[model samples]
Target: MATLLHIDSSVFPGEASSTRSVADAFRATWEERHPQGTVIYRDLAAHPVPHITADAWSAGYAAAAERTPAQSAAFALRVELMEELERADAVLIGAPMYNFSIPSTLKAWLDNVLLLGRTAGETPSVEGTPTVVVASRGGSYTPGTPREGYEFVQNYLEAVLGGTMGLDVDFIVPELTMAGRNPALSALVPLYEASRERAFGEAVGRAKELAERFAA
Candidate 1:
């Protein structure tokens, strides 16, 4: 059976936020499809990693090639996060766009997971796996459209998650605030709900197919 890691970085818990709900829905669908598979969850909001400090940066650089005493000590805490991703057959990340960018907490988690020569490197195939990113945004960010100005989040994430790591990145975006006035929001509510369901179902299906093909 495959191992799946489900991560959520949304700070809000209730209806005020949709990231967690979206992630939960995805995890549920995946569980149903892969009954024998193991699913591990990490909530960054409840347990966040401190921002990378000077010491952490120094350790990371010092141990860029091999682990040192200082680097090993600092990296001990991050190893759990890295091991989780490394052992997983697939990864599902749910994050909300904050100020046209990803949350710092999520970025921190990425930094820990995208270790040199581990998750990525100068090698041709840096990433040895596939990942799906489900981004929840309050506005539309389709390029070439009027709201294209707000597309930095998706662009930045794709660059890091796909280009740098060489992971097959798939995205699901549920535009929330773009629906406009109360009446429009009311109309959009059902659409968002339906989109969430479809997105989760599709992700679960894809993950299952991948597991059967690669992990079997």
Candidate 2:
């Protein structure tokens, strides 16, 4: 059976956040499709990874394959997270576009996982697996639209996750377009509700499909 890691970085849970909802839905469907598969979830909100400090950076860049006692202790935390990523056959990330970008917690996790000679190296590995990013935002950021200026989040993520890491990436962004107008907020309540449901359902479907194809 294959192993899957689900990473959720949303601060909010039940309401006012679409990231968690989509992630939960996807997990449920994935479990149903692969009954024997192993699924591990890491909630960044409950246990946030510490940001890279000066000492951590210094140790990481050092040539010591065998680190000092202090460096060994510091690098332990990062190694734990990277091990989880390496063990998984596939990964699912649920992030909300906070202030037109990904949350700092998720960014920190990325920094820890994408280490030199670990996740990537001088020669890229041909065996690198696939990753799916389920993104949620309050505004629209699709291309060729007036609000497309907000599209920096998706582009930046794709470049880092796909281009740099050499992983196949699939993204799903369901926009609640009518929520901006104060007067329309109330009128568009039903639309926002329906959009969330649809987006979550679609994410679940796509995640299951990918899991079956790759994990099989």
Candidate 3:
């Protein structure tokens, strides 16, 4: 059976978080399409990966036989994380915007998994794997908007996952998620609902399509 790595970095759960909702729809559809497929899930908000430390960084570049005990343990996790990425036929990331970028937890996971000589070094281990990122933001940042250049989630992810790792990455973003929650964004509630609907719809469709395509 094919393997899928599903990672969610949202601090909030259920209906409160747009990223979670869209990810849930995608996962559900993907499972329906490939019931026997293997799913390796990591909820970063609950069980966040460790940030790369000086020791870990040093260990990552060292020959495996030369790593010290502490470095060995730290580097071991990195190996496991990279192995998951390598084994998966597809990857799904639920990343909510935090301060105009991805959550720290998600960033930490990326740091652990994107190891040199494993994930992208030597040759890209996950090259050509389909990676779907559900990038949810509280406000809109489309072109010409005041926050246009401030949006960094998708761009940064594309640079790392697509540009660097050579993954076939696609993004599904649900913007203006705070419209009904925050008083300042209350006026955009209708637009927020429309955007949410469209995002979820596309997410579900994309999930099924990818699952079907990869099942072959």
Candidate 4:
């Protein structure tokens, strides 16, 4: 059976997070498509991976037999994370914008899985693997928007997931997510609703498209 690596990095739980909810929708569709598929789920907010450390960093370059005890301990986690990414047929990530960028927990997960010679090199092990990202944000960051220049989440992920890691990535963005609750964004509520609906549609369509592609 195919395997999916599903990751969510929202600090908020369940449907409270736009990215998580949209990602959930996509994952639900994907699971329906492959009823017996294996899914490796990681809730980064609740169980954040460790930040890359010197021991872990050094261990990647050292031969297994030469690794020190400290290096072995730290590198074990990175190995597990990397193995998950390598084994997945597809990857789904909920990377909501936080301060114009991705959450620290997500960053940590990336760091753990991104070893230069393995997952981030010229020919990454997971190269061409399909990956979907739900990139929800509080405000609009599309081109021509007031905060367009401030956009970092997509740009950063594109560079990391696509550029460095060589994964085939598609993004489903739900913008202006704070419009419902924030008084300052009240006027944009309609647009936010539209965006949210569009995101869900895209998630479902994309999930089906990718799932079918894999089945063929």
- Name the top lDDT candidate: 4
Ranking by lDDT: 4, 3, 2, 1
How accurate locally, in lDDT, is each candidate?
0.72, 0.76, 0.90, 0.95
Show model 2 residue runs off by greater than 4 Å: 63-66, 121-127, 177-194
Residue pairs with backbone overlap in model 2: none
* Per-model C-alpha RMSD: 3.3, 2.7, 1.1, 0.7
Q: How does residue 91 of candidate 4 score in lDDT?
A: 96
Q: Which stretches of candidate 1 lie over 4 Å from their true place?
A: 14-16, 63-70, 124-126, 177-201, 211-215
Q: Candidate 1 versus the native: TM-score?
A: 0.81
Which regions of candidate 4 fall more than 4 Å away from where they truly are?
none
Please tell me which model should have the higher lDDT, number 1 or number 2. Answer: 2
Of 2 and 4, the candidate ranking higher by lDDT: 4
Clash counts for the predictions, in order: 0, 0, 0, 0
- What is the Cα-based lDDT of residue 143 in candidate 4? 96
- Residues 1-216, candidate 1: write the lDDT tens digits: 878888888888854566666666667766776788898888888888766655555665564567666677677766677788778777888878888888888989887766666666675233656677878787667767567887777788788878877777778776664454456567677665666567667666765666566545
Name the lDDT of candidate 4. 0.95
* Candidate order by decreasing TM-score: 4, 3, 2, 1
Q: Best-fitting candidate, measured by TM-score?
A: 4
Q: Which residue pairs come into collision in candidate 1?
A: none
- Give the lDDT of residue 74 in candidate 3: 84
